[model samples]
Target: MKRESRQTTGGQAWVVNRKKEDKKMEPKWLTERRQKAAEDFKTLPLPKTDEFWRRTNLSRIPFDQFEPIQSVTNGAAKGSASRYLPVPMMVSGELLYGEKMSPATLDPNSQKAGVILDGLQNALEKYPELVLKYFGKGFQNRHEKFLAQNEAFWQTGVFCYIPKNTQVELPILLASHFSGGNQSAAPRLLIVLDKGAKTTIVHYASSETENDSIFLNNVVEIYIEEEAHLTYIDSQALSDQTFEIAQKRIELETNAKLKWVLDIQGSKLSKTNIETVLKGSGAAAEVLGLLCGNKKQHLELYAWTQHAAPHTTADILIKGTANDAAKTIFQGMIRIEKAAQGTESYMANNNLVLSEKAHADSIPRLEIEADDVRASHGATIGQVDAEQLFYLETRGLNREEAEHLIVEGFYEDIFGRIPVESVREVMRKNIEKKVGVIA
Candidate 1:
């Protein structure tokens, strides 16, 4: 892993453990802003013993020793970007990370409508107006240590702008792989869509080397304006020895549409949280996730849907498999405010245990203040049906082959729903490995 100050495309250097408020004489203007943010972070409290964290063993996370992320000057050390999608993936007409990245490409029509897509650090200086308007506004940290920690430390990120009535045909991929040395990375990603705009986002996580990395403290925030349509697909396949804590927030205005899918199959300790705030009437959100854990790995996921407006709708499905001594937790929530009349929401979680030693938990919650709203949730945990396995074995298949066929059939239902073919294939292969069917 490279140090935080490693050189990259521009003359700019990466930051590590650098705060917004430090008295360093780097740049007075930026220093002042950084200082303010640091002050705010200091005032926030870390998450302690709480109902929300009851199921999670927070002590396992290395919270006390927080370090800055080292930068990568050796672009050749980084791996090529991958997209699990049929749609062609590129940034500014060139394959992503094909060469050293300088500036992102923007569509001509989007450019004509004042849409902007640029590096986060560069955009902070170029379009301060829009950055200041949406950054950290929708994602308010309520004394959470990780959120506050990210707010103080994160420096580099992405900035996207979409003007009214504009639509981006292709999805944008923000894929970066960090091979860790001895430091931690606090990656920050910010996205904004103006009213009546539409776009898709794909963010991937990778590593340069398969070293015993520490932490990838990452955060991503999305702000969708009124009537906007947003689709976000995230894939994380970091090194198995690493630990990752990721958070994604989505804000939707009236009649806005949000679709999200997550495929995670790496890291020894991985915790991912994705939330959607429906702030507009008739707003809708859909989420689907696939994860696999094996060999003492621990995977946790939290998905939340907040209905702040009337007639909002939401649907969520999360499926995964655990083998060996691997463990996984699936927690989901749906909240309907008093004013959110006629809201509709549904959630479901299904898990397949491949080994007797494997463990998994599912928790679904609903908080409703509107009696007129409709909300429901369901969760199931079980092993492969032995009767079905027996039927397959009688057809000249071995016990192992029979079980494999049953497990594949079980996952086919959810995998068929996956919109991205590349992602679907990745999930299929991962699931097969979990069942010891595929190498």
Candidate 2:
């Protein structure tokens, strides 16, 4: 049987078609999430020079030159399994939704604590109420056309739920592979933590295709309920030839805690929107971002913290290095509402420019409607510290070695925050590759 070619510009149809299939294949309670999101996607116009995107560069986005990911019926499954064998997972298979497969099952061990960890399709069939209750509950509605496109077309996704009072020490990993013959990839994630539950999730987005895969767009939604604890680690290594658009939203309830990490290393042009909302008193949220751009890559990251409850605390730290004419932009904002008394939040961003041709910008903003809140913001853009390099060189290090050592130290603060040993080690290895450092 011949497979239908997917259109990049009309990617919305891919999601809409999937929605239809899902409606027939999924439970009735869960259909509302995709339906409402599709409608919201249709109404929300793409952002252009808007307040939120003032410092962003969208001229290089090749929106029309991309298409949805093609079906993996042609040995792609076996190829991926063989490639990722060393990686730990209950199932290294592709993520599927709707009536096509049994909603991509998870390991039975995850179910031992009343947790439901499966793809979106399965959540619809078995835990529709949970998925609908938390989807888009904290994400922003204002964004560019790509965001709407994501809402309209996000069919294949990872879904996880931690039941009340349960604790999951092992982290759950969700990796999205976009290695189509000639197509775009649209993926989504929905995570929920029941009252007093605790869990951690790791999301990895990458392209296995060695060829020119035009584009990949993804959206992820997370909910941390009352007294729940959630730690999320997100990493991206898209093909250097591809374009990427991604959004991540997290909500926190009373006394809930969230630790988030964002890391990026590949892709020609990429934009990320990460945000957290404190909805209950005494809630806490922390965001850490690390980016390395080389070879003319253009990247942008925007992080936001919204404190809507009293005594909430949030902090953000973003660090990155750009080399070989690469460019990076970081814009973050923190808002303390009038009702958010005694709120405290801080935002800091730093960048290391390894080459004169490389460029980076940092914009941090704060809004405090409550006079009793404490907020602070800091930004630094500069080259490596010559004194630090000189000191390292005095210890018998070569010029390249001295420079690499200083840069690595500069990023150690963020590196220290990656909770998982394996992910942290991978982060260090990727850093070494980016800076071409040995050992």
Candidate 3:
């Protein structure tokens, strides 16, 4: 099938169409959704000045020059990733070389209770019914531009579906890299945990080359059924020239639990949103975000947790380190509906400014309509205390070394809560690199 990605004026970024390439043999269901998504991309004006895009400027990016990744249905890409992956993962395979997706089947030793773990193409080929049943179901009401663009032009995706009552003890990992050349990678990931199921996923996205320019538009959807549990960690270390616009939405049923962590360590300009909806009684969620911005980097993160059921609970904590001329924005909100009684929520945002030019903004909000509920929010923006710096320096450390230690202590509370050792190590190393330390 011949396909092409076109860049049009206005809000549309890239449109992938096979109409003139191949239409006669296209499946009816596949063609219709793709056609509708393409139409959405065309009609939906890219939010140039929308409130969502106000904090991070999208006008500077050359969207028309961004190229959509080409899909390769071969084995060479897998071989490349095998040499680069850090054991137990097939990251950066076809997605960067020529293939659009990295597909996998359940590991006999790791997977139990008939769980399904595969890529987008694999699920579409083997489990078409299930894939169609859940795809785009979580965000049917969100009319965001980047979300629609990602749905329309995604070249590859990851799908993890846990069976009812099954528990996966091992942490699943998916690593991906983007090569230089001003290309765009749209990866759509879906995670579904059935009733009483439990699992953890560690996602990684990085740059293949330091000097390369790239744009990443990604979407992730998580569905938690009654009494299920899901822990997800997203780590990004892209090139300094990369532009990223991403969104993650999660839906929780009765007695479900969601633990989410987002670590944004690199990118020239990054804008992301974390949305969680508690639709059933007794559902609970915890959201945490950590970011380190340096050298003119701009990062904006928004989080929203809505409580529509009684006895639901949520907690949010966001921490950041900004140095040089970098800027960071953190916005969090918790909404309790009128019918949701006995709801509990707490939101907090803290930042450490390491330079005089560095800037940070924090906005925490709460909307409560029900009775017998507890909700509170707090935000703080401060720098290293002069007395503490002097105390550390007098103890024999230089300014850089003392500052580094102070920054580490600033994020210790949040870092200690991360369960994965490897993830915490990655975040620590990146922070140390950004903040200077003695060799």
lDDT of 1 at 53: 55
Q: Relative to the unseen true structure, what is the C-alpha lDDT of residue 322 in candidate 1, on a scale of 0 to 100?
A: 80
**What TM-score would you give candidate 3 relative to the actual structure?**
0.90
- Residue 67, model 1: lDDT of 49
Root mean square deviation (Cα) for candidate 3: 4.2
- Mark the regions of model 1 whose C-alpha exceeds 4 Å error after superposition: 1-16, 19-48, 63-67, 70-80, 83-102, 106-114, 208-211, 389-407, 429-439
lDDT tens string, model 3, 1-439? 1111323232343554334422444346766766677677677766767665677777656676666675433343433433333333422112222233344534574454677766666677778888888889977756667777776666667777888888877666665667778787777887789899888877777775465678888798989999999888777777789888889899999999988888887889898888899999999998888988999999989898899999999988899889899999998878899988999998999998888999998888889999889999999999878999899989999999998898888889888888877678777777777888566
- Model 2 C-alpha RMSD to native: 5.0
Looking at candidate 2, the ten consecutive residues that score lowest on lDDT are 1-10
Question: Residue pairs in steric clash, candidate 2?
Answer: 8-66, 8-67, 46-144, 46-145, 47-144, 67-184, 69-184
lDDT of each: 0.70, 0.72, 0.76
Best-matching candidate per TM-score: 3
Taking every candidate in turn, the Cα RMSD to the unseen true structure, in Å, is 6.0, 5.0, 4.2
Which candidate achieves the best lDDT against the true structure? 3
Cα TM-score of candidate 1 = 0.84
**What lDDT is reached at residue 100 by model 2?**
23
lDDT of 2 by residue, 1-439 (tens): 1111222233444554554455465555445545665665555545656776655555465444555543222222322321332344333223332112223334465566677766675566677666777766555454346666666556567677888998876766666665545467666788889899987777666665565555667787888889999888787777788777778788899999999989888788888888788999999988999988988998889898899999999988999888889999898989899999999999999999988899998889998899888899999998976787788788898877776777778889997887777777667766777776755
Candidate that beats the other on lDDT, 1 or 2, i.e. the better one: 2
lDDT of 1 by residue, 282-361 (tens): 99988888777888888989888899999999988888778789898899989899999999999989998877999989
Between prediction 2 and prediction 3, which has the larger lDDT? 3
